[model samples]
Target chain A: MKLDSAGLQILSRHECVALLGSVPIGRIVFTDRALPAVQPVNFVLDAERLVIRTAVGSKLAAAAQDAIVAFEADEFDPGTRTGWSVTVVGSARAVREPEEIEYLAGLPLHAWAPGSRDHYIVVGTEHVTGRRLSSVDVG
Target chain B: MKLDSAGLQILSRHECVALLGSVPIGRIVFTDRALPAVQPVNFVLDAERLVIRTAVGSKLAAAAQDAIVAFEADEFDPGTRTGWSVTVVGSARAVREPEEIEYLAGLPLHAWAPGSRDHYIVVGTEHVTGRRLSSVDVG
Candidate 1:
């Protein structure tokens, strides 16, 4: 697979959606203590938004309250040197409605760590974008 | 730049250190309202600990007041089909001492975004780990 700078710059909406739909994990970016941070999380696509779960008294809960956040997911094929990444920027909020929480909880999401998984953070996207890199582009 | 599973595992550690040392950006993972949430942040490596700046109303400050947190960083290179990721898991705390805050402020770190930088969230890492992926492993 080959990619050009122009192609990388102009990602179609369909491509963005595809990337988001195909990948289940991504890095979420937000501000904590006035510093930039990113973390890997398994998310579900809910009504074109990203949803995740965590525990109370977690760092993520503290930093993302009504704040601007960025979520990203990508897949790269090492053999062919091809990969695409999609990022969604939006504000995050804690879901309050019982119905919404129950619906989100039914998703096939699991935390790799052990703790009381009792909190939820939803990133409501304002913008969606993506970029791709490939060996063909270099050639 | 080819790698086997074992090589990928070894590179994960190097990737972790590199991710932590290369920049002031990291991600905070925690639970938000019973769901998992992640946000990006700027951090400094202080005495092997990850330090960040936050404010009173900030999420990090609230989370770190008394809870376990996860901080992470990584760099992915699609060209060589190789990349590394690092994560630090530990407890976070607020730096109240004037001397410590002043010393941290002197570090060569800058916000990747624009905003009024305040407060500080420091994650004292009790564990650090990383991982890599390659075609061979996937195949």
Candidate 2:
């Protein structure tokens, strides 16, 4: 296991993507009124791209268009103090093509929030990084 | 159960603070190299302030100094389809004063990562907002 300067294990890109696929929810960080804002979102990983469905007039939809955003997903066990976190920094853009929307609509991406979530914001996996904390092996 | 325009329940300021105390982990969004980045860290809520401990030369400590960042903490039950998320947008300043650092070091804020985490970053509760999604009560 490779460890970073902080003593946390470094995860490869493949491991990060796989861990992302196993999670159902994540937090998307975007600029709101020129300040950083984070909102919990349910997203689907499609071929290294993050597909998020939201309302057309929502704040996220407006801020994420042709913007750089950060998406993070992780699972932690506080009891044993073990977990892994994966972060992706990339450009986000809304899907405007008809055929693309139709294809995304069938990708099993369901919105947990109430209301019509027709806007599909896709975040590219341009930069990916992950870290893990594991219990020290004891004989 | 007051619902917002998006049909999600709006959590009061008091509720948001209390929920933040219930959890020991959260995601902090800050700028890294002029782009947004999200890192999960263990934090403690001191009254209305959020305290985080990190390494002195780590990226978080460097970027969080006197910067406006976003902190989010939430808990969700996937089986019940219910969750609540609270976000705090405020300025994060490193505790440079020796007296303040000593006081903060006495708090229960502990780092989960294995490292010499001596730098303490305190985020004030400038703008706090929260939303919740609950299952409809049939009874």
Candidate 3:
């Protein structure tokens, strides 16, 4: 098992994808007005791609279009001080085609916020990296 | 109670800072190699600023220096579909003064990862905005 400099275990690409699929919510990082902006989102993994549904006119839908964005998901326990974080850095493109939107709508992706989320932003898994800190390795 | 377009409650600056102090962990968004990167970190709020302790030569310490960055912290309950998310967009600067570092060391901010974390990155809370979703507002 490869370990990072901080002694956390470096997760493999496959492990990263698996861990990402385990979580329903994630945070997306994009540039807004030339400054970095992060927003928590609900997403689903589809064949190594992260699909997020949001309002068509939301800031995320505008800023994330055809931009290099970062997506992160993790689960941590304060009492145990153990958790795993997976990050995917790639280009985010809004899905526009009718057939593709129909297929994506068939997925189990649902928005938690009360709104008409009609836009789909898909981020490829170009660079997938993850680190896990187990209870045994907690210092 | 101001409601965002998505029906989430818009939190005031006072409420945002209070919620930020409630969480010990947060995600920091910074630029790496001209691309956005997000990393989860252990941090503590000092008044209106966020203090992060990291290794001296880490990427976070390097990428966040004198740059605009985003810090996000939140708590969510999946079953109840309720949570609060606070985002702070501000400039990040490294704590170089020995006396200031010494003073920061006195804070209860302890690094979770096993390593010598002697570097402190302080992010100013310039534009703080937050949203809260309650169970009663669930759709």
DockQ of each model against the real complex?
0.05, 0.50, 0.60
List TM-score per model, in order.
0.52, 0.96, 0.96
Off by over 4 Å in 2: A136-139, B136-139
How does each model score on lDDT? 0.64, 0.90, 0.90
TM-score for predicted model 2 compared with the true structure: 0.96
- What's the best-to-worst order under TM-score? 3, 2, 1
- lDDT, candidate 3, A1-139, per-residue tens: 8888877889999999999999879999999898899999989999889999999889999999899999999998888788999999999999999999999999988788887888999999979999997734232
Docking class of 1: incorrect
Q: Across residues A83-114, which tens digit of lDDT does each residue of candidate 1 receive?
A: 66676778899887899888888876654334
Cα lDDT tens digits, model 3, B1-139, are 9999877899999999999999889999999988899999999998678999989889999999999899999998888778999999999999999999999998888777777888999999879999998834332
Candidate with the larger TM-score of 1 and 3: 3
Write model 2 residue lDDT over A6-91, tens digit each, in one string: 89999999999999999878999999999999998889999899999888899999999999999999999888778999999999
